[model samples]
Target: MNIELWWPKLTPSTRVGLLENNGDAVPPQVVAEVTRAGGSAAIDSDSEESDYYLSDEDVEWIETVTNEEEPTEGLILSKVRRT
Candidate 1:
């Protein structure tokens, strides 16, 4: 999924909710939206040692969007399967 395109489409409230609650508290409607946007939820089995490493582009995008040099944990943006 191209998160750059999907991120801008989210409602401001939803975006704030996501940032505040992180992935765990994301509503089903938002999860559906993410799925429809070609994003998948992160599996519990996944680990730092897994193959699903975020690219430099993903990291840069996250930093830019969150405006944090180090983004908080559990962001759905971090879960996006960039293709």
Candidate 2:
């Protein structure tokens, strides 16, 4: 997907991490996904503040290499016990 078409779909609330001085540019699909999830995204130097951060190369991987069908299927989940 072209970044120009999907870039506007990103909401201000979506947080995206971007590395400075990296040659790669963020794909619009990533931004669209973040916004669709109702989260905030931005390219910033500080990773501590952002909910999710990724390097320029990482971003490219996410957009091109990452599996879109099962985005988070590999994660291990645990049930929380109530006090």
Candidate 3:
């Protein structure tokens, strides 16, 4: 499944922690906290629409956040595939 996370802004430390251990799925508590912080996570599908959207840069930012230790900015977009 494709999971997209949209947030106004997140601290660098928080971004790393979010993807450190969790794979494929993010913890519910994290999701809840993000929601409280004006963020949202939703399934990426052809039919269903999400309240939040990510731009090309936003998508690339997520890739950098997940793959590198360097800090990133803007929204978070993570795509997880289940076997």
Best by lDDT: 1
What TM-score do all the candidates reach, one by one?
0.45, 0.24, 0.38
Model 1 / residue 21 / CA error / Å: 1.9
Which stretch of 10 consecutive residues in model 1 shows the poorest summed lDDT? 49-58
Off by over 4 Å in 2: 1-26, 45-83
Greater-TM-score candidate between 1 and 3: 1
lDDT: which is higher, 1 or 2?
Answer: 1
TM-score of 1: 0.45
lDDT ranking, high to low: 1, 3, 2
Model 3 gets an lDDT of 0.47
Top of the candidates by TM-score: 1
The candidate 2 region of ten consecutive residues with least summed lDDT is 74-83
To one decimal, what is the Cα RMSD in angstroms of model 1 from the true structure?
A: 9.8
- Per-residue lDDT of model 2, residues 2-66, tens digit only: 33233345443322332221234345665458456443346665545433333443354345322
Per-residue lDDT for 43 in model 1?
Answer: 32
User: What lDDT score belongs to each candidate, Candidate 1 first?
Assistant: 0.50, 0.38, 0.47
Question: Candidate 1, residue 2: CA error in Å?
Answer: 2.9
